[model samples]
Target: MGQAGETPGRPDEAGLGARLVALGGLELGEFDAVPSGPAGASAPAGAPVVRTGEARKRGRRRTHLISAGVAVAVLGFFGTAAYLFVDVGGRSPSAAPPPPRKSYPAVSAPVAVGPQPVDQGVRTEDDLHLVCQNWYHPSAPRFRGDSPHPILISEDGGAEVDYRSTRTLNQAAFAGSSAQRRAWAPEPRRAQLVACLDLTGPGRPIRDCTSGSKVLPLVEGKYRLTVYEVSSHRKVVDRALTGADRACPFVILSSVGDTLFSAVKDRQLYDLLRERVEG
Candidate 1:
């Protein structure tokens, strides 16, 4: 045992070396020198290197996983690029967006607004006229629902230009003690008084503005009214109506007419209408 291995020169050295050799392992600090591996079997003989079946399969699987990951990454990159550049749904930035529809806040309940001013005009409409199809004429002391007035229409109101001056509701050139007209409607030549809106501005009916040829179905909205005294072109009354108030677009016009009429100049009629409506 003495010279068969490297010497442990002293008795104490020999005893300590025997004890350490018997140990399975020793606890070590991070910076402590590590012992070399136990003496091992040498590589197999003739071919100089060898691989087991399990090791070969593990290497193949690792290669396959790397290839699959690369393919997925490539697909993801191109997909993102297509999404950023393509106009998938044909919507283009240059196309003008449709105008937003107008909306009005509903009043707490259907109520009247004013016989106030031309700037604050009443607007009423439904898909089709029911109660509102006609207008009232105090001169005739009756109401007619016919639009654009059988008489007293704007010069630009209809295609009746050929017979504009001569046409009447009936076949002949006739006289009517009663007449039907709207607020924006031009007054009869004989009316002598003008609508109140005539002084402020003209209210263009939706029917008048868009087509001007045919009677369009009424759309949902408030209907506005204004009146003018024909001869002096004096504005008698103008106001706006919402909801139920829309039932009578030019309700004030008749009362206002009373103040202007020579025969029935009831001055309180205009004030009475205003009080009722404004309430």
Candidate 2:
């Protein structure tokens, strides 16, 4: 049997060449025939090559999948961050209190007391001069006629006024210097004035006692002096004189033995008694 255009039963080389030329329409080409036996024929020369088109397409598909996965991961991270920020922003802050204000004092009504008569010519320390004067309510407490009165000294710049009870204790101390027992304190719990006020004005005149003080010459004996205001209340003081004239410059009102001190009785009685007392 013949294989394709091969000559069978004849090992004729010319016939094989002629068959090859007839099958391929070649112009009597010369070729060497490869012999096949127990030993196989040698393979054709040159290296084997694979096409790259399908491999390049598969690599591009893998790259696209990886990029999509990275994009999804980045988007999830950003969304989670935004959700946490919103949750933290939903809480509140703290609350606080208010402030304070300023303050002042209240006004009061004027007191009820009569004015005093100013004696301008009543100057010189030798004569008893009335520099200042004041008054108090009759119902006000009074320990004695010589107690501190509602009278302030202009020399102290009108800052304070002594009540009637305080004046009494001070004068008593002065008078009690020669007594058997000097007064260390005021008499315990006596009827005296509580408060006093100054009712003097600039129009009123005062005797200037800027220089020497007054001296009242008296015999060695004990004498009592009573002081009266415009009303009936009186203050009396029993003064003892051992030596010469004493400077009784300021008036001392007292209520020692009598119900009313003479100076605090009526103005006429006080004037009459003061004149009779012989300087």
Top TM-score model: 2
What's the residue-level lDDT of 57 in candidate 2?
A: 45
lDDT of each: 0.30, 0.31
171-197: candidate 2 lDDT, tens digit per residue? 333544433112222232222211121
Off by over 4 Å in 1: 1-49, 87-279
Per-residue lDDT tens digits for candidate 1, residues 14-129, read 34324433442222321122212212324435523333345434544665677689999999999877666556744445554777999998769767642222222122221011
The TM-score, computed over Cα atoms with residue i paired to residue i, of candidate 2 is 0.22
